[model samples]
Target: MSTPFSPRLIKGGLVLVDPDTAQVQRVIALQYNAESLRRELKGQESGEAGTDRAEPTRFKGVALETISFEADLDATDQLEFPDQHASAVAHGLAPQIALLESLSQPSSAQLRKVNSQASSGMLEIAPMLAPLLLLVWGAGRVIPVKLASFSVTEQAFDPALNPIHAKASFGLRVLTVDDLGFASKGGALFMSHLQNREQLAAKAQPVSLATLGVTGI
Candidate 1:
């Protein structure tokens, strides 16, 4: 009997990169791939309801895009090997959950600095910025995004009330050159993502007008 063939799977992940140096700071890979991904796009039009009729269909820039998905994380398998996965045995999924939550927060050091400056009666302090975040789905799609929202539901817990199984839902707004500007690393990545989509669209076969029961306008 011959064995059936199985295709290789690629894991999707979120990566945090240093904005100035373009160095990867952290990588959080989803334990299980999302069952489905939802995406929405809204165009930036030049004309509004009361605007000029001319160039009504003109676009100011790339359309705003957003993506949402749910990822599942379980510590069942890790709990079996307590020696190696001691953290999972004790904290369950808390560490993993915290890692995701930290993406939206500034570093602890930054917070401390601000507090110190305020105590010293400093008039002004610079705003804190989070690391640049990248959503990598596959070889074909990688783009910068801002975490708009995040929610996690603890489904199962261990005897100690530690969450062992959970589902994390993420809402992300795709960042483009308009948001990041052409000089930024994220802006460059957005351009590459746009060009890749254009290339993919070009590869798609096109049908003539005859297919729609029309020869010419």
Candidate 2:
């Protein structure tokens, strides 16, 4: 008997990269792929309405894009082997939840530095910059984004009241050259994403004007 072929599964993840060298710092892969992803795009109009007839079709730059999705995390499988997965048996999914939450939060090191400066009587501390965050859907799409919103609901818990199953929802605003500038690593990644979109668009089949009951404009 011949064995049936099984397809390989690709998981989506979030990647944190250094802004200067583009080195990947951390990768958080979704335990299970989100069933659906929601995306919204808003065009940047060049001028006010009725300012000029041609201005209606003009655009200032790339459209603002946002993506949202919900992922589920569960520790049931790991809980079967308590000795091997001690952390999962102890804290349930708290560590995993904390990892995602930390994306939007300033690091402890940065907070300590700020506190030190204040205690030393220093004024006008500079703002701390976070590492570039990238949403990786697949090989075709990897774009920089800012965490707009994040919410998690604990569905199931262990005996100690630690959450074992949870659902995490995230809203991400796609960062572009306008936000990051061309010199930054994030800006470069955004450009690559844009270019990939253009390539995909080029592969799309075109229809004739006659199909829409039009001979000529």
Candidate 3:
């Protein structure tokens, strides 16, 4: 073969058979002797092929997965490939790497849930505000307000009156001003998205129409 086969990289170790209990253990990276192992494996494959059967690649064992939460964990770090398998750590020790991975997935789900809730709340409440503000502003403009009262003596307007005995009634009211854009924007966006979805759905369902040179697009 003119092209070279890529070197097989092993993060987990070789499989070792225990004679006493008939159990297999993963030996993880005792060391990375990639070139040496490559040469040997290639030689074995080439020699074994003379028998007319497909040569099996070396190193088929359980995988040892690692986590890289920190910036440092990469290809350069060399940890010993254990001579023993998980039979030792299977009982007591929990790897921190796997624990971190477990939390990562749930954390992402939590953030997504929080974002959806915030969006829902914004959409639910936004429409009520705009109309309310508009109503308040309209009310303020239309209704005359005078919470404090002042009385002028009849002498000030007594051109043709006997003590100016006409009674006047005044009413005061409070109202909220409506801010249309602040309140209605969220609802408008939601409705717009819904309409867009309807449009997309209408376009998607197949129908017989004039062929425009785009058959199965």
Candidate 4:
């Protein structure tokens, strides 16, 4: 496990965890960032019959919520991975690339089980393959996400072509219950996550007695 940035202050950042093992694989520190939350509404136009006037239905349309964030990474003086032998600045992009690549590959265990089942005519055993299919879905998942985009611009490089100074931007679209059906693991986790966040936020903000007592005195 990676140690906290400092003994006194806790380092905060994005954590990529293994879906199966629930192990933290990487932690990228939070820097300058922006979050985008979008909602889409749909409605039908209607008219009372003749007056050449149209109005939207009183009923509200379905709201689709999406959230995304862009964060910057600088490695000039920051050690992204202290345990590594190379210069932190020079090797900053290593973990980012590794995460992308890892996400692209499916889990070996899942694949082996799937292959084994197929070889044994498992389809005949369970044509729908309910339980097994669910497990196989998103095998080797590195953080439940619909999309992850990253771009790195190397401003400076060492003699060995390793980046010494660089700027990287990373973006993510979290997978929610809507994206991954409610039956799936990701969907369940997403719902639980929302509930947890809601609770935390509620607790984080408390009604201050000092403020209430000073109202309009």
Best by TM-score: 2
Off by over 4 Å in 3: 1-183, 208-217
The best-first sequence of candidates by TM-score reads: 2, 1, 4, 3
Candidate 4, residues 1-217, lDDT tens digits: the string is 4577645433334555555455555655554343432323333345566665666555332133333444444555465455653545455555554554344345667678778889988665332211111111122222345344556576766566665554555444556665666776666766766676567688786766676776554
* Cα RMSD for predicted model 1: 2.6
Tens digit per residue, CA lDDT, model 2, 98-211? 999999899999999999999999988999889999999999999999999999999999999999999999999999999999999999999999999999999999999999
lDDT of 3: 0.28
Give Cα distance to truth, residue 72, candidate 3, Å: 21
Worst lDDT 10-window in candidate 3: 128-137
Regarding TM-score, does 1 or 4 come out ahead? 1
TM-score of each: 0.92, 0.93, 0.14, 0.45
In model 4, the clashing pairs are none
Task: List candidate 1 segments past 4 Å from native.
Answer: 1-6, 48-54
Prediction 2 global C-alpha lDDT: 0.95
Every candidate's lDDT: 0.93, 0.95, 0.28, 0.49
User: Which residue window of length 10 is worst by lDDT in model 1?
Assistant: 47-56
> What is the lDDT for 153 in model 1?
99
Q: What is the C-alpha local distance difference test score of candidate 4?
A: 0.49
- Of the candidates shown, which would achieve the greatest lDDT relative to the real structure? 2
